[model samples]
Target: MSKQQPVLFSIGWNACINCGACVAICPQEAGFVSPFDTIAVDRPCDIACLLCESICPVDTITHVPVEQPAVSVVTVDR
Candidate 1:
């Protein structure tokens, strides 16, 4: 049976510095720096390799675990 991969999301262009570190380290070639000066996630990647987060010089890249739920909740009692 084929293994399932995790869904990938794109980091905003403003936060990306166009550093090629993500591209170099990704074994899946999931990360790429576009011509428009933005970092893009090419496809769903479940590599679990944190190279992109570590190699980002500007600290722009962030890899959040998919299983973790958001802590924020809205509660209204009236």
Candidate 2:
């Protein structure tokens, strides 16, 4: 049987300081920074490793587990 791939997550550019730590530590090479001033993670691989989250000097990056989604709320006034 084939192993299932992990879901990928993206890092916010506003929070990222363009550090290459994520790119270097990723075993999958899933992390990369584009010349256009953006950070990206390859789908089915990103998995929010949090390595970048810890190494970031500015504390701009955050890692959310890919398999989980945040719940949102909407309220209606009676």
Top model number, lDDT:
1
lDDT of 2 at 69: 22
Over the stretch 1-78, how does candidate 1's per-residue lDDT look in tens digits? 113334354565577766676667656543344554444455344555556667677766654445422224323337
Per-candidate local distance difference test: 0.52, 0.48
Give per-residue lDDT, candidate 2, residue 15: 60
Prediction 1 TM-score vs. true: 0.50
Tens-digit lDDT string for candidate 2 (30-64):
33544533345443343344565576567665433
Return the number of clashes found in candidate 2: 0
Model 2: runs farther than 4 Å from truth? 1-5, 29-39, 46-49, 60-78
Candidate 2 global CA lDDT score: 0.48
* Residue ranges of candidate 1 with Cα displaced over 4 Å: 1-9, 29-42, 64-78
